[model samples]
Target: MNITVKLFATFRAGRFDIESRTYAEGTTVGDVVRELNLSEKELGIMLVNSRHVKLDHRLEEGDTLSLFPLLGGG
Candidate 1:
């Protein structure tokens, strides 16, 4: 399955803003996070196909996954 990943905020550091990658069926959002060496504790909002979803949510082909880090500014 092909999934489009979009990283926002600090998550894009040393990474890309958007990229398409292939994953096995039944792959969850958490899997991608781990693959990218991202820390779950720093994760803020998550969306799949523009709908809010959980980390364990399974992904489908052609799905667009967006990851955002917890914002910190005062």
Candidate 2:
């Protein structure tokens, strides 16, 4: 299946703001995270097709996944 991933804030540094990636069936959000070389601790909010989802959530074809890092500023 193919999904679009959107990275926000510092997550976009050295990476793309948005990109389309292909995954096998039954792929979970965590699988995508790992493929992106991102740790679970670096994940703040996750959304699949505009709905909040857990790392274990399964992805569907044509779904858009958005990942945000935990933000902090003085």
Candidate 3:
């Protein structure tokens, strides 16, 4: 299945802003994050097709997944 991933905030530092990639069947959002060498503790928000979802959320073909890091400011 193909999923469009969007990285936001600090998450984009060593990654891409957006990219469409293929994954094996039964892959979860957390799987993608880990594959990218990201830390779960840094995750802020997750969205699939514009709807909020958890790390365990299953991704489908043509689905767009967005990831954002926890916001921080002084």
Candidate 4:
């Protein structure tokens, strides 16, 4: 199965450009997040198909996943 992956902010700056990944069915968002070695502090929002989803959410083929960094500034 294949899913689209999108990275924003520092994540993109980190050179995580593959944009997508192919994994076996039943793969969870947390699985991919861990594979990328991204820490919770580096991850802001997670969306699947435009809906906010949790790390444990199961990903399906053709799912579009977007990751963003936490915005911080005074």
TM-score leader: 1
Off by over 4 Å in 4: none
lDDT (CA) per prediction: 0.97, 0.93, 0.94, 0.86
Identify the leading candidate in terms of lDDT.
Answer: 1
- Per-residue lDDT tens digits of candidate 1, residues 1-74? 99999999899999999999999999999999999999999999999999999999999999999999998779
Sliding window of 10 residues with minimal summed lDDT for model 4 = 12-21
**Model 2 misplacement above 4 A:** 72-74
Could you give the C-alpha RMSD of every candidate to the true structure, in order shown? 0.8, 1.1, 0.9, 1.4
Per-residue lDDT of 24 in model 2: 99
Candidate 1, residue 24: CA error in Å? 0.5
What would the TM-scores of all predictions be?
0.95, 0.92, 0.94, 0.88
- Candidate 2: worst 10 consecutive residues by lDDT? 65-74
TM-score order, best first, reads 1, 3, 2, 4
Error of 4 at 62 (Å): 0.4
Quickly count the clashes in candidate 3.
0
Model 1: residues with Cα > 4 Å off, grouped in runs:
none
